[model samples]
Target chain A: MTRTTYARAIGTALATAMRDDERVFVLGEDVSAGGPFTITRGLVDEFGKDRVRDTPISEAAICGIAIGAAQSGLRPVLEIMYIDFLTLALDQLANMAAKAHFMSGGQLSVPLVLRTQGGAGQRAGAQHSQSLESWLCHVPGLKVVMPSRAVDAAGLLASAIADPNPVVMVENKTLYFRSEEVPDTVEPVPLGQAAVLRTGRDVTVVALSGLVPEALHAADALAADGIEVTVIDPRTLVPLDLDTIVASVRRTGRLVIAHEAVRDGGIGAEIAAATGRAAFDHLDAPIERVAAPFEPIAVSPVAEDAYLPRAPQIRDAVLRTLGRELNREGCRLPRPTA
Target chain B: MTLDTGHQITMYRQMVRIREFEERVKRTFTDHPGVIRGHTHLADGAEASIVGSIAAMRPGDQAIATYRCHGYPIALGSDTSALMAEIYGRVGGICGGYGGSMHLADIARGFLGTSAIVAQNIPQGAGAAYAAQLRGRGDVVLTFFGDGATKQGAFHESLNVAALWRLPVVFIMENNSFSVTVRTEEEDANAAAGEPLATKAKAYSMPGTTIDGGDPLVVQQTVADAVARARAGDGPTLIESLVYRLSAHGNSIAPPGVPLHYPEHEAVAIYGAVEEYEAAKRGDPVPRFRARLIESGVLTGDQAGAIVDEAQAEMQAAVDFALNSPLPEPAAALNHVYA
Candidate 1:
């Protein structure tokens, strides 16, 4: 095993895919120059400018070109600099890329991967930090995967590049620099599989993307209090690993879904509704959700910290599912009836 | 760029086939009411431009078009019966009823399908050219769209990239006078300023030319020159072929209860310009080319009559086959959602 950051792991995955297959190439704005976060650093030198292409700031054309290239027999990995900017290319992504295979009646397959980052930690303001995975998950032919760990970043990316359909890999900008020990040769982690980071009997806490680390940390803190919280990370949002989540909910009989996106129509709502139906008889308490309020992510660090859902909010959510509350000074108290 | 007698006869035959096929599609609304659902756009007056542009392509070359897509696939040698079935949304469709008139694709014939959205296929055509460039093959791609598509950002961005990378693609914009009901001059800056739409290519540093779309020989020569330049790795060229659309934008869009039919030409219906529509009818490319071929001794009068007879029989067979084909199974919709 070797220690690496999330950014390096993704870069390694791109290099490995390129080395394994001559058809694979990378294109985006400043991708050859390593992009804004340097996630694609050192690729141009290895693959040359022909393979590691830098394009104009035209998201719609970039996506359409990628789709066309994929249809013509190249596996293009397009990087949209920010998930928020993806809105500019939604017509191509949602209409063209997502519908090509189906619209062609199986005569064509778009083996393309669109990589972009989202999450609110750096004060990048509203435009750069929005998590729009829910928008992609709503599409029929798209597969949306978010890798929270360095190891999964390499593994899921390999699988996504190998898959025959269009896959949107939404990385977290906040996790780019976080370091972890990943295996020297990371295996392909198949999509639609959830990882149970922590197993406990008290409650099942399902966290996504950047919130996985926060949930694990919350699990550790709750373990100290003998709560024994169970934390699960759903690596992919589209073909959700509902079986594992439902099994955990059945055993624990309490659930909390957390993410960095707004709760109005976040992925957490889908999971909650699906799990609520699948494990309705097994539930012992109401399901809780820990997510951002319905508003734009703030630019101020202080307000942003309050805006983001973190370990404290997750811990409170877990506590709320157990009919309890955590007051100031970190003390557990009896339930407060409304 | 010069076409021999046999090649000219073949071009005439292809143009006749497209014209006959479109006439049948237009007739289907009244004869076999509701056999075709949704919107169906026709390439009636643009037949010569479509046939001429496709005639420039070689074996490995590919083409992508807008929703007015039937003419290219027909010229590319896709089965006419399957094309008709696709328009009829039958199980025997080229796309197995998955794609209707706007989405016919025959990849084996190098017809890479089309986009229903305006100007969206421009960048995709550049992308296919990018792939052809990477393969080190001299193959080129032809992108077909209407004059209205120039107003979209996709058009400008794709042109800039295709020129910048020297991608092997040719942009063929059939200037059919109107976007839908709105005339081109009302929306386009160049048209409003009394300039050809091909002038837009000047901003991208690529060669742009304008030609009469009604003459098959002119379109074939112009597109052939552009194709040769793209194959030599010189970059993309934009050619604006001016023609007049003889049919409405599409079959009248009505609810299920209201029967769909082809309305009058937009000029006569919207602007009351009966003279303009009549003038375009007088210069209809199919018969114009047929008369030219016969007069030039490239095709005898009897040979031209035989070609028209064959095209009518072929399209009649297509219509019959589509009428006999069954509707696709509802469960089949679940297929092709993933791979």
Candidate 2:
């Protein structure tokens, strides 16, 4: 098994999908010449210009062409270069691809995948750092996937390629160079499936995409202090794995949902709602969430860190879930005087 | 008239089908209660634009259009029954009643679809044309939008790309004088009446033409010329069909003074005269051709009337077919939400 970065895993999946199906092609600005971030290096060499195509700097046209190609018996994998630019193609994604099947009485299917990157930490600034998984999940026909690790990246990409509908596969810009061991085989992980990173009975910590690793680290630290924490990663937001989240919350009796997006209208709210509805009776405390503050991400690195959720916030949320009162210093739950 | 007749008979039948079907749909809107309340942008005056353009295409050729798309789908081989059911928002409608008036799609008929958003069809149609070009087949694409849509950014962008790539697409603009109550004078102060709106295509180094949309034969000749030009790899052509809107922009817009602006009071009388005169012309299609059918002893008026009657009956039966069909299962909505 070759160890690879999450970025490499994505490239490998693209190459594999292109090799497997002649209809599958990639289109984006600078995608042929190493892409905007070098994720697609060496693909053009193998697939040629016809399959690995470069497009003009038009996001709307890119998405529109992908929809047309998909409708006419082609699987077009479009890259928006950045998730923030998805705003430009919202009409194609929202009105065209999402409603094609339903509005056409199931006669049309948009077998397309959009790979784009989001999240903060590299000082990419307000324009490029928006986490829009929540915005995409709002649309009915769009499938949303955000993978945290190398294996999940490759697995989810293959699944999205095979999907009969449009899928928005978001990768974290900060995690592109982040490395992990990716098995040689490409096994598509089923969408709406959540992975339990750690098992504990004290509290449940649900995180998404890039935030999952921070959540696991926080859980490990808390476990050393005798506070066992269960960490969960909801891989796909649209078909949210509510069953697993509810089961974990039912066992732990506490929930803390975290994501990199701003607190309001974030994936955390959807997960929090699902957890509440499914495991309302099992709750020992109110469900809590840790997310970025509702403000434009700053261009400065120091401010960017402050804008996103961090390890300490996860630790504090976990501590609060265990019935421990938290001050600036940390945990302060007094033992019961039975 | 004759079963072995060429496009002449076929185009006439298709145009009559469209004109009659639209008229019947208008009657239903005024009569049906509890039906959807929205504007049905009927293609009454512009029937030739769709019929003539579609007549020039082959079986595998493609079509796409904007909101005023009922004619294109009907002309492109969609069953008249299904189309009527769609406008009525029945379960058996082309889009399962989800797309009321603004959206109509029938993939089986090669009428890709229509969208409510102005100019959205431009880029999508160009893409399909690109696919046809890539396949090395002589398949052509016919994309229709109104004069109002010509002002959109996608229109300019799509034209640029289409001209640059020399894709096999024919752009037909039904310039119907008004973009929803706003007269063309208020919007396009420079465009002369009866002149081709090809200024944009000029910038792209492409050719364009203007034709009388009220005359299907003229419209047919112009489109055939453009399709031929396109098939020969001459790139896209911008064909403007100058016609008047036979009715208000939508059903909601009532007469100017009498609370309902249903075209001018004499609009129907005028179009009716035109239809009659054209029917009377010896060379004109429709009734004259129907007469030839009877004169040649192939079929009697009663037989032709029976076919029209059967079409009407099938349309009525489709309503029942739609009404009896079950509503989509609630779970099915969630099933397609994701792949």
Candidate 3:
């Protein structure tokens, strides 16, 4: 296995898609300069200027034009420099690209990929730090994809590009530099397929994006105490693999869904509702969702730290789902030795 | 002026057909009462603007239109039964009945689609042209939106990029004298067409024109010139076809059997002063163009009457087709959401 950073994997996915298909092109403000995240760096040198268009700072054109290009026999991978700017391009992405195929009665397909990085660990402040996957998920014609690991990022993005519909790939900002083992030849991770990272019969923990690793770490920590936890990563949100999730929940009979988006109206809430309906008879305990509170992510490091979910928070939620109560002193463990 | 007699007759027939079709759709509701069972925007006054310009385009060239769009696909020669079925929300509609009057599309005929959002079709048209340029295909794209859409940022950005990349596209602004109810008056006839909006195209380094939308042949000749320029790789052009919304912004979606509020000849406060309506009525292209055709002796009144008769029969057939079409199965919705 070749070791690659999450950002590198994204670049490789783009290069592969471009090499595989001549119809694929990349456009956005400063994309030729590799964008603010540097994921698209050096792709221009290989594909040439025509395919890697450096658009004006007009998000409307960046998105709307991409949709137009898609329908007119091109697959455009458009980058919205920041998820905050998605508001500006929502008309084209939500109303135009997402609705074209269905609204057109299958006459046109918008094979477009709108890529943006979101989440708040780097203190980029409120605007740049929102996990707006829920907004895209709300739009019926769109496919929402978030990959937690470097390997999955490359695979999922490849599949998203090959699909005939519009896909929103919201990457986690904090995962850019994270390195992991990647295969020499990558296989596309199909949309709506969940990956079971750990096997445990006691409880099921569904994690998304940046929180997947935290959930894994928390599960390992819980394993030390003989309370095993099942961790599932729902790679894609729209064509969600509910069968895998509900089946897991039915076995565990308890669930804890997690994400970096706000606690209310986040994707986790939808997952909770779905599992609640499908696995209602099988559930032994009430479902728990570990996520950021309903406040906007703060710029201050201290406040941001408190806002994001930690391994212990996920572990504690899992522990609670397992019906573990606090000691008389209200602490989970005895006082630490000096 | 250089148009052949055959082309002029074709243009006249197209104009009369669209006018007759919209008139029939406007005044004839079945099953209960009112004109149409659903609300639809008519192309009564803007037939010249739509037909004149589109006549210059070759078949299969990419095109887009705003909400008042029946004229666009009709001018492009899309199947009448399909367009009417779509507006009727039947399974046989162009969009399989999913898209109503405001969202008709026939991508196979190269009329890419239509949208309800003001000025939204501009950038999308530009993108199609961008694709053409990338593939080295010198196909020109024509996009139509109302004057109210000029205020949208997409209009400016689309023109800017189309000009910057030398993308083959024609940005047609149908300046129909009103922003729904707000009067956007310009002094000179030409100026009123698109003076402010067309002249602003200079900022993007593209040629812009404010032409006589009242004359279909003029619009056709002018747009044909721009289409040539685009195909020759001269980049995009902005042509503002000044016309009037001779009808209501759109017929109200009144339920069958209720007295329809927005009629063809009723002038009310919602449409501005009666004087404006009266003035616009005098400029209606349908009767004026028919008179001109008769005066030129290129055609007789008998010929114009026959064209209307044929258009009426065809429209009646389309209405029958829509009424008889089936509904989309309920399970069809769950499919095509992906892929």
Candidate 4:
């Protein structure tokens, strides 16, 4: 096993893709100097300026170039600097990238990956830190990938580069420094596939991005209460690993979906709606959605913590679905007096 | 470079076809309201502006234009029947009826696509150029927009990126002096009415030129020079074609059923009567070019007249084909949503 951080894994994956395919290139602001988060460091040195091009401060052009390059026999991985600035490029991303292939009667293919960072733990203010994955996930043509682990970052990006359609990789800003034991030779993890982090029969906890590890922690805590919650990390949200999630929910009869995006119109809502219809007959109780409240990520640490969802929220949600004791936040009570 | 007489005639015929097609589509809407859906923007007086610039490009070069895009595809050699079917919302359309007049795209001809939003194509065009540069290909991209697009952030962003990277891109701005009903005066208080829109290209370290859009031959030469500079890896160029839109901004920009109030020359003239206004329609690109072709001996009067008649017949056949084409199956919508 090789230990690596999410940022390094991303850099390695980019290097690997560039080395393997001459058609694959990287572009963004300060990307040659690595990136704002240092995920693209060392790429320019190895690939030279031609492959690892640094673009001007134009999100629309960055994304538009990716789309054009993808359509014209190139795989371009572009960075937007921050997820909030994605607003400026939504016309190109949503209207142009999303609709080009379909509207062209399948004559064109946009094999592009839009890489951007989003999360709210570092006090980077509202504009810098925002979990806006739900907006892209809502679009029809776009594939939204949220990697929670270092290994998945490398694996998913490799697959995204090779994917025949447009994919948006939303990297959690806080998880950039997080390290884990990844394979020495990282293998590509196919998109629309979910990984079962923990095996439990009592309940199913489906989470994404940074919340996956939190859900696993919650599952460990619930084990003390004789409640085993199945934790499933759906790496990609678009062609969602619904089969794995629904199968797990059918086995457990209760479900809890967690995400960092706001509760309203969040991706968790879509999972809840899908699972409700698919596993309706087997569901023992209503689906519980554990996500941040409908508010922007605040600068204050305390307010941000309260506004975000984590392990405690997942544990409480699982217990409540199981008809266990109630506690503060009106959720289920904690493990008895351990 | 001087275009051969055959090439000039071809360009002229294509321009006539574009005008005839738009006029035919407008008649379809008037003669049959249900033929087209929603509002439509027609490129009537801007034929030379669109056709001349496209003539400067190689067949493989990518071209993107604005919402007034009907003329560009025809100028780029897109199938007229498919374009007509597309506007009529039929399965046989270029985009299979999914993209109407506002979103006509023919990738086969290197026409990337058109965006309804003003100046949205600027950044996208820059991207196409960037990709070509990355691949070490000499291909270039021509992005056509309006002076109104100059106010859009995408326009400036595209220029900055194209200049910084020295990408092969030609930014063409058709300064028609109006953004819908709002005149250029109200739209841009910064620039004078007759100011050259091309000078804005200097901020990005690229050559900018303003030319008379009424003459196709001049437009062809100027854009050919810009496209040459781009293909030579020297960088991007901004070409502002001073033109006009003889038709309503959209089908309903003017009064409910009015064709056009008057041409800009007659509208501003003190003694500009309706007859003079009608006479100024002679300045429209089709007739003006027809006269030029005759005077230049590139084609005789009989030959030019024959070409116009041929284009009108072709347009009528396209309308017939569009009306006859079937509606796409409902399930087709779910097919390409992913790939």
Every model's DockQ:
0.82, 0.38, 0.79, 0.63
User: Which interface RMSD values do the candidates have, in the order shown?
Assistant: 0.6, 1.7, 0.9, 1.4
Candidate 1 CAPRI classification by DockQ: high
Clash pairs, model 3 backbone: B29-B35, B52-B220
DockQ, computed on Cα atoms, for candidate 1: 0.82
Q: Each candidate: fraction of true contacts kept? A: 0.72, 0.39, 0.78, 0.65
Writing each residue's lDDT as its tens digit, candidate 4 over B16-115 gives 9988998898888667666776668888889988889988888669998888899998988888999999988899999998878888888888988888
Model 2, B22-116: lDDT tens per residue? 66666665445334345577887676667877877887788988888778887887876666667766666777766666788998888888888
Task: Give candidate 3's TM-score.
Answer: 0.95
Off by over 4 Å in 1: A328-338
Best by TM-score: 1
Tens digits of lDDT, candidate 1, A16-95: 99999999999999998899999889999999999999999999888999999999999999999999999988988888
- Candidate 1 chain B lDDT trough over 10 residues, lowest sum: B1-10
Candidate 1 deviation (Cα RMSD): 1.9
Q: What share of the true interface contacts does candidate 1 keep?
A: 0.72
Docking class of 2: acceptable
- Against the hidden true structure, what lDDT does model 4 obtain? 0.85
For candidate 4, what is the DockQ? 0.63
